[model samples]
Target: MSTLTKQDTFQSLLDSASSSFAPIRTQAKETYLTQGLPALKEEEYKFTSIAKKLESKIQEFKSALPFAVSKEDIESVLFEGFDGDVLVFSNGKYLPELSTSPEGITVSSLSQAENTPLGSIAKPEKDAFSALNLASFSDGLFISVPKKQKVEKPILLISFNQANSGQVIQPRVWIEAGDFSEVTFIDHSISQTEDPYFVNKVVEIKGGLNSHVNYYRLQNESKNAIEVSNIHTDIFQDSRFTSVNLSLSGDMVRNNLTLNLLGSNSEGNMYGVYLLNGKTHVDNHTNVDHTIPHAESNELYKGILADQSRGVFNGKIFVRQDAQKTNAFQQNNNILLSEDAIVNTKPQLEIWADDVKCSHGCTVGQLDEEALFYLKARGIDKNTATGLLLYAFAGEVLEKIEEESFRSYAISLIQERLGSKF
Candidate 1:
């Protein structure tokens, strides 16, 4: 008898559940098997080990309702003092009773959207995780902003994992902004139970011509949890898209953000900050594709690793042959707070257009001792001084956020993670 590997076990589970969505399940399995695990040899995944950990942590992707959190329980999770269109999901199930959206903004479940004209945005893809999510997603949010309208309030989608029995949860969301429309979307993930589990989430965003969209993600799962999220966005002519990712907690985290500039004069900005402590591991992989002329993109990712934590950043920018006069810039910076902390930073640029302006750079270094001593000499404690310096280092990135309330909230969270009250 032959022994079955972890991949085989997961494949078997997928096969048994084929009746749910046979075609998607089959495609996902095939992609997983063919792609195997992205290794360091793969240029796009050179800084991260996604396949290795997925194989070890997930024996099989089991889907079962272990526990359900109530609407009232989810209401308390909202940003306490902020005003926004709130949508809450618990254990991958949407809790409509807890969601609120004023007039002019349309919000519904993916299942319902599948029956309407909005279904076009929910089409399944060949990517393994996205395929799996499309096949088995129980609940997700579908948000639409009408054309020529500006949403006064932000749209917040809060995903909660409250399973105490350690079950896998998948949450998906699709957002579409019409031409000349403007909106802000935020995705927040939290865990209520201490039991270990997996969170697989997918978000698809489409920005129409002359539209503007700002998306932010806060991944603050428990230390015992594992999280994998994929965000795919398409920006049209004269449209603008900005995505900010802040990862604070998780045993292992892998985030993939892909942005496609489909029209001329479109702009995309990607920024991320990951603060890791203990044995936590965080990896961020991003791609900016400039397929049209005169498009622009800028990416900046900064990380802080303490104790035995590890951080990885892989950013790639591609300017196609027809993308003349395209401008792209990328930078990855890291600060190791302890000797045991490890960081792998990689920034890459592939330009086939000679007229494009592209640049990419990465840096990994320790805290500045000279600056630390200068602060300590002024009667500041070592810990406090270090925390202040870390905050200053992160401030450069935080300043990029244009919204005051959101920026303040993010700064507070960063301060808390740094063990300071700044």
Candidate 2:
């Protein structure tokens, strides 16, 4: 056995990747060869050295079938009181036997779908991770909602990684909402192993005229696992798009969310919360682009870091020259619970339109000592008082979740992380 260099690891992956993607994959490999993995020197990845992390886990990138997962494991993660349609993927392979076929929507494997919605809103050339997913993925999940159809029940996508030690999984998803269609989607990722592994996934969403799409993503990976997820969405005329990301725990996690308002009067809302502890690391990068006049976008992200954990946030809002009357706002806030905890936050706005209202800001600080003292004096113990204050600090974002059950689940996860009774 010998230590592998970064080039060797990447070459190995390219050598084993499928040629089914054709010229796209060919171009991606070429780009990767030139750009390689994102390094610390790259401005976009300055705070997080993903190349180093990927190199460390390079040996885990093996070709193996999905590891066995019991029904009990599925039951444990399901949302209570919800009987909606479900799609389960084990090690990035769709398991039909464990999924339910729901109506009002067309579902198909990407190989069988009439359209492969890639390189459109989610540009592979713009990012190496997206390019890697396009080049390496075997099959993908595709869902299409018909015009004027209201998906009464929420659609659930469970991406569970069950692989042996030192293995990797890549899952891809594409969702399309037809004109006037309405749907709610939940995307979740979990792992069953305590051993080191990696999961890389990409999600693309297209919203047609006047459509409404609500998307929520929850990442609760094993302590030894690493995950990189890129989600890109396009909003059309008069449509509405809202998405929230909750990153609970992982050895290393990176999330990239981009929303493009392509038509006038479209609306976009982006929110996220990351509660990290131990030696975990989480980074979130969000981009909201307004290309049309009269469009609007709002973004807010918060993080709670304890122990020696680290968090990073970079949000950018871009208003094109023709995007007059556009309204865009971005804000990021963080609380460092321990002296060792660290957070790097940057909120940026690039506005070429003079009439646009664009503002961006970020704040990094510790908990409110006066608030904690007040709570403690009100007959609450120090631990409980601290937990309550933290809960209140996160409530602003948690309250945005519309689903009661999901909201409760998110709150409970926060409480568990806080070590508070209640």
Candidate 3:
């Protein structure tokens, strides 16, 4: 008998599941087996030790017990005053009873969206976690907006995890916007049980000609949970795509965001804010590929780390040879609130075209003591002053959010996390 390696065990687990996407699953599992997990030694993952984190929690992915959640329980966790159409998922299974039927759009299961562009955006061969998600996803959301029609309201996607110990949940979502259409999409991830679990999520968005799509992701899972997510977007001619990511709490979190400018005169903007403390870890890797002429891309990410927490940010922009007249900008800023806190930030640009304007910069520093003293000298207390400054630093990204209610709710959460009463 041969010894079962970790890859062999993972492949066996994949083989046991029954899915309509078996062909894609088989190829993805094979790719995962060949490539395995990413190591810290790799340049792309130089600052993140994802392989170590996965090895430590390898057993949790073997078997997942059945878990159920009620509609009331799902309602209790929603952000107050969010009236958007919703799609709910529990333990990677769609819960139609807890979701509201969207208007002016076509919403169906991923398996049912065969005639649409269901699996065109994701490239599992490029990353191992994406391949893992492709191999084991139970069910997913498939949304399509028709040509020249605008979705009047935002669509909310909530993923809830009620897990026993040693469970793995994989959730996938695909959004396709028709030409000249406009829509807003929001994804929220929350966990109820305190047990340790794993969430591997993949989201793919396709923007058609002259369309506009706005996307937001909020992650606040259990403190003991591990979450890995991949977001891939393709923007077409004269289209616009905006994305915002809010990472509040988790044990180990990794997010990979990639945007492809496939058409001329396309626009892309990406923003993210992460507040980390305790022993939590968050890593965000972003890539913007400009393949055509007259495209523009902008990205900004801010992080606040306290106690012994760690954060990593890596932003890369690539302008291909034919991508003339491309305008790309990237920035990453971080504040370490404690002596034990750590952060690694890098902004890079690779341009093969000459007639392009591109810039990249990053900053890492501590809170401004002089400004804090000035605020204290004025009638504010030390804590209030600290909170105000932190808020001001992070408010830039928050203000970019187009939804007012969600922005206000996010502000309240940030204030609570900063220990400010006001």
lDDT of 2 by residue, 1-422 (tens): 12333356545556677766576677766665555567676788898877687667655366446766667778888887766788888899877788888797888887778647465766777777787777777778888999999888888888878766656688888899999999998888887778777777888999999999999888898988888888999989999999989999888888999999999999999999999999999999999989999999989899999999999999989999999999998899999999999999989888898998888888899989999889888899999988888888787888878766677888888887886749
TM-score for model 3?
0.96
Q: State the local distance difference test value for candidate 2.
A: 0.83
Show where candidate 3 strays beyond 4 Å.
1-9, 63-66, 116-119
Highest lDDT among the candidates is held by which one?
A: 3
Q: TM-scores for all candidates?
A: 0.90, 0.96, 0.96
| Root-mean-square deviation of every model | 3.1, 2.3, 2.3
Candidate 3, pairs of clashing residues: none
Model 2 Cα shift for residue 277 (angstroms): 0.6
Alpha carbon lDDT at 317, candidate 3: 99
Deviation of model 2 at 325, angstroms = 0.7
What tens digits encode model 3's per-residue C-alpha lDDT throughout 1-422?
11223444355457666667878877877877777777776787787776676557654355454367777777786678877788888777777777888888888888877854434677888888888788777768788999998988788888878766556788888888999999988888888888777788899999999999999888888888888899999999999999999999998899999999999999999999999999899999999999999999999999999999999999999999999999999999999999999998888899999999999999999889999999999999999999999989999999888977678888899988987648
TM-score of 2: 0.96
